[model samples]
Target: MSGLMQKEYERVKLHATVMNTLFRKEPSDSESPRLARGQRKTRESFDARSVLKHFKDYEFGSLTIPNIHLSQRFSTGQDLYYQCVAMAALPKS
Candidate 1:
């Protein structure tokens, strides 16, 4: 899981860098006003390190994985069964 997370983080960082570079380039006069404004805003506000830090913190920092163990004891030749469970923490509204 850690290895996969690291790879995803690296990918996101690279994508952010590419997007920032693209945003930094000036658009031609024929470009739409809305697009030009959006690009300007992104160039001014996008911080790759900050974005990466947020991603790391959200995915790794606050996440919790509890250790779960299952045990079974059978008597009188009865069968035993167990079901898998999954849980997630959602933000409170």
Candidate 2:
């Protein structure tokens, strides 16, 4: 992944991890109004937005081996024993 992608991921992760604590903690009366206003003003709109906008479609590099072979070889629990074998057989792109 590019530096830009890493930066984006970290921004989103920080935003989410920070919000996780905020969401779980009980807000004092003084904190509630400011918090609600922050929600309204923030471009993300909500905590879910931070998480949803990032990581959903992050790169999963191409697996060049035939999809059909992968399916046939690893589709069942018994087949998983063969995945490492199949995986090692595959040439790195």
Candidate 3:
């Protein structure tokens, strides 16, 4: 994939991973202003460093893509696997 496409993919993956982690953590103090007001608060926002730390040293499975046309690359599933692995290997930054 092109660098721009790769970057965009990474951004989306990171966001999803971070959001999942955030919601999975323990609930925040309900005594806080926002919560005290009875407003619902699901998860708090965190910095990139925190998200990177959560995903550091993670690894994903590898894949082998068959030699084929772009349009049919993922028809056999291998190409999709390869793309997922490629995106997972991207930098956490």
Candidate 4:
């Protein structure tokens, strides 16, 4: 009777292991080529000049801020200086 119970317990354990393996979901290792191609197309179509031009037009036309009065260059330089300082302060990996 004890031998039979031990065999039944082993069988049930093996069955549970097999069922878990069969139902487990595996993660995809790589992205589909179609998705990669679509991403590349989107990256290719991004134009920095067009974006800058749009912002420039909005700033001047809507805000009525003349270029001569704008300190954009100075502000950009200041931002870059702070960014550089912050990056330099980060510990090297």
lDDT of each: 0.39, 0.39, 0.42, 0.32
Reference-based lDDT, residue 92, model 1 = 50
* RMSD list, candidates in order: 19.2, 18.6, 13.0, 28.9
Q: What TM-score does candidate 3 reach? A: 0.22
lDDT of 1 by residue, 1-93 (tens): 433212323333211123534235556636745555324344365557977877775654464435432222221122333232323355554
Which residue window of length 10 is worst by lDDT in model 4?
65-74
The ten-residue window of minimal lDDT in model 1 covers 69-78
Give all TM-scores, in the order shown: 0.18, 0.17, 0.22, 0.16
**Model 1 lDDT on a 0 to 1 scale:** 0.39
Clashing pairs in 1: none
- Of candidate 2, the 10-residue stretch with the lowest lDDT total is 66-75
Tens-place lDDT per residue, model 4, 11-46, is 332111113232233365255343453242232223
Off-target runs (Cα >4 Å) in candidate 1 are 1-20, 23-45, 57-93
Error of 1 at 82 (Å): 54
Residue 67, candidate 3: alpha-carbon lDDT? 35
Q: lDDT-based ranking, best first?
A: 3, 1, 2, 4
Which candidate number maximizes lDDT?
3
Candidate 2 C-alpha error for residue 89, in Å:
15
What C-alpha lDDT, on a 0 to 100 scale, does residue 78 get in candidate 2? 60
Tens digits of lDDT, candidate 2, 28-91: 6467655553253333325577666786788858656532222222223464322322222554
Evaluated against the true structure, the overall lDDT of model 4 is 0.32
Candidate 3 overall lDDT versus native = 0.42
